[model samples]
Target: MPGRNDEDNKPVAVTTSLFMHPASSPHAKTVFWGMLATRPDRRGEKIALLLGAQAIVHMWEKEGARGFMTGVRQDNASSAALCNRLGISDTDWTYSVCIDPEMLGRKNLTK
Candidate 1:
């Protein structure tokens, strides 16, 4: 799948709100590298690299970012490698999401 369509033109990838760190946090100016996944057949084309670099650079210039960071699962070697290739470093920090296991796949609307 080339994942390109002049017909529908829907977005294939999304950048999420996880990148929005709190202003009060010490790492406020740090840019979170939001990674995009290409189709399995499209891997190694460095498409992720191009998009990531653009997003990172835009944030750096627009927000005056002091550093860049991202959250990748410890088991995700590919993502970690991309992070490194983009000139970002991994931290000892752990990212956790608190949600009830039973609530998964259900509409848990919480403000």
Candidate 2:
């Protein structure tokens, strides 16, 4: 969580993660920065950068994390820019397919 005032301890920006990915190599330490968000009002204020840096420091110092990875949606330009600013390269692309639960039970779900 990252914020400017104690009164707003509820975090303007937040980063959360698991210490390791299930698919990660056992011989090395890894951390997955699973989620990141900054309040709509706080966007472009570097709150996300502050929180992200704090998370990385905590992982390296407290958890001995040697590898870090995260996923950002391709359409999220701000997030992609943040990643670029942080020196993280876009190494791969991931594709996802989703279906509405209501449509799951429908017979003609060709859409």
- What are the lDDT scores of the predictions, listed in order? 0.61, 0.64
lDDT of 2 by residue, 1-111 (tens): 233433556556567755644545672576776366676666777877777777777777887877777777667777777767766667654535476969666543111
- What lDDT does model 2 reach? 0.64
Worst 10 residues of 1 by lDDT: 10-19
Assess the local accuracy of residue 84 in candidate 2 as a C-alpha lDDT between 0 and 100: 74
TM-scores for the candidates: 0.66, 0.67
How many residue pairs collide in each prediction? Answer: 0, 0
Give the residue spans of candidate 1 off by over 4 A.
Answer: 1-19, 99-111
**Relative to the unseen true structure, what is the Cα RMSD of model 2?**
7.3
- lDDT by residue for model 1 (10-99), tens: 543333212457889887876655546654544577766766776777677766777776777677777778778888777776667676
lDDT at 38, model 2: 70
- The TM-score of candidate 2 is 0.67
User: Top model by TM-score, which number?
Assistant: 2
User: What RMSD does each model have against the real structure?
Assistant: 6.5, 7.3
